[model samples]
Target: MKYLLLLLPVFLFAKFASNESCKSCHPIIYEEFQKARHSHASLFKDPIHKAAWLISPDYKKKKYTCAKCHTPTDEKLLASFDYKQTIMPDINSTAQKDGVACAYCHRIKSIENNETQNINIISKKEHVYFGNLKDTIKNPFHKTANNKRFQNGNVCIGCHSHYRNKYGTNICSTNEHNELDSANCVSCHMPKVAGTPSNMKKRKQHAYHGFAGIHNDITMLSRYISVEILRGIDRFFIAINNLSPHALTLHPMRVMQLQVSVIRDKNVTNFKSKNFVRILGVDNNMTTPWKAKEIVKNTSIKGNEKRVSTYMYKLKKGDIVNIRIGYYLLSKKVAKSLGLQNNKKVNRFILLKQKVFIIKPNSFAPLQQ
Candidate 1:
């Protein structure tokens, strides 16, 4: 009977209200959230996540480990539902479809510990909303409270920093929170916009709810990385500085490459290429996704980390060296495996920076005819 009970299906009772309920009172915030990636973070809309979950046997077996960040709810409430037998709340209910909705985030009272995943969420009945502002006005829906952690980047660590696999291996470790000694995640991603959070309130500068990141525009990518080239005898030194508070590519699945080309007489020749990747896999082969055993090669630029790449070449007086850097959302192999060849989210290599440097004749060397 005990063995049979282990396989018994669990039913979940809805403990939290949906985003639709909050939309009536806070229409402006709801609309802003609608435009953000958080609204589409569910498995239904996010192709990459859907693909990863679909391909994983553990997900199909009702392990539900991915649900924490993807469709986070009270874990105690989630324990009642059999993920394999029942549909995910996001897919089944309209209110839950608003992924990472207002109620879900507002319910977070505090973080119990310094650990990235140690989130302390209050039950829905508490009707408490936490924010960085101490002088928030009273709301009919929920009590407003001040949470200093919300003002900094630490709040984002629970979902953004890291996630481990069942084998005690970190499948993804963004390390964005701890990487920078200065600015927090909100400072960059959620810049202050001049507007009232609610329609009833007076206009004031508040953190925008779009929560823009890698999934959005490439503007952040361009702003954070600065490239400088130094000319030397028979070689070129390229320096890439990470100006952002986090790693250049926060997502472990993403890849960035620096390409150098030699241009002469209108003909372009590939000179050298350096790849920055966060390697993770189950075995030494280091090819598996989500089953990462260890990080093998993490060439990613950490917060404020300066990386210098050197290329040795025999240069002519007229040769023009071109340097270009690009960010790819996914490696070609990973995309192909996930069948994301034509997917809209699977973007092509976004060229972030490009510069051309002309090689001048050295005082000791004769000019080529």
Candidate 2:
């Protein structure tokens, strides 16, 4: 089957074997994963699990996008982009799962290169992530080698750097190959979480079902963006104070997302267009006006403010933009559908923005400033 590539990485590569194969060498680790969420992440046979799917609005008790990351069992189920697989095995259960697996990220090549690089190239290890098997017994489904991109920042870029134009069009314009911001998946989603365990061995320990994302609260606050333009390096900074209270809200089966955008024209506002929107406070549990278009993408920060952060993309001197923050409480119905109903994690979304001015290269400040 043509395997589909999910943006997340799997467990580090290791030799493969059945549950029995793993017991011989990894006595403790095996015991851990044996009970690890992998066993049931994609098991459709569970009656309660199936029942929950029946009541879900989006999935009708079937598979959903979030479930794919939590429960990827076989690449075949995901390869087609089905978005409904109930059981996605834990690739991070071991190197065999390669975190998400050799299949997911490998299928995604450098979106910038316009080449068809697959797992062979994307799986290469790097300094950020040294993908090597310390040592392991050989298993068919598993392997131990230096996967250069295995733990590198590039692994998460596939999904993180998403954008939409003046229209609510989903564009994948990640800062790939653009190192100015030094932003990548891990930079935001997996920034070093203190006391989370950093030793290579520990990283492997946490690989199973412990994947990180834009959901970590402390990690997000720890990082900051300091913007300097060329008109000679005008210094401006912005911050996104995540509102979820937690890194990504508290929930097992929940929905969490953030979208920022650039607004160029107020007169061009087409309330009927999906791009226009009216902001809502956390108390109001409603969506944007159907007739209005909201700039639901990235937020902007002020270069002049000691630290400014807006939920919408900031406009350049002559630029225009708006920001929107969205959060959806993972209804018990939604969670039950994903088999995470019992996981009472509130799904939260927050966005902030400030004005951004376009300055010429190498100039310190905008002449007007």
lDDT of 2 by residue, 1-369 (tens): 123334223322222223444345445444444443334333252333344444434354444433344333244444544644554334344322332332343333343322211112233332122332355344443445544343454554333333332334322223323331233344444344323122223333423222323332322332342222222123322233432212232222333333334445444321221111222112343222111134232222211223233232222454333323334444344444446545444333323223344433343342321
Off by over 4 Å in 2: 1-73, 79-143, 147-152, 163-168, 171-344, 347-369
Which tens-of-lDDT digit does each residue in 234-285 have in candidate 1?
Answer: 7767788888766676566788899998888998889657889877765455
> Which numbered prediction scores highest in lDDT against the true structure?
1
Q: What is the TM-score of each candidate against the true structure?
A: 0.79, 0.36
Worst 10 residues of 1 by lDDT: 360-369
RMSD in angstroms, all models? Answer: 6.6, 14.3
Error of 2 at 80 (Å): 5.6
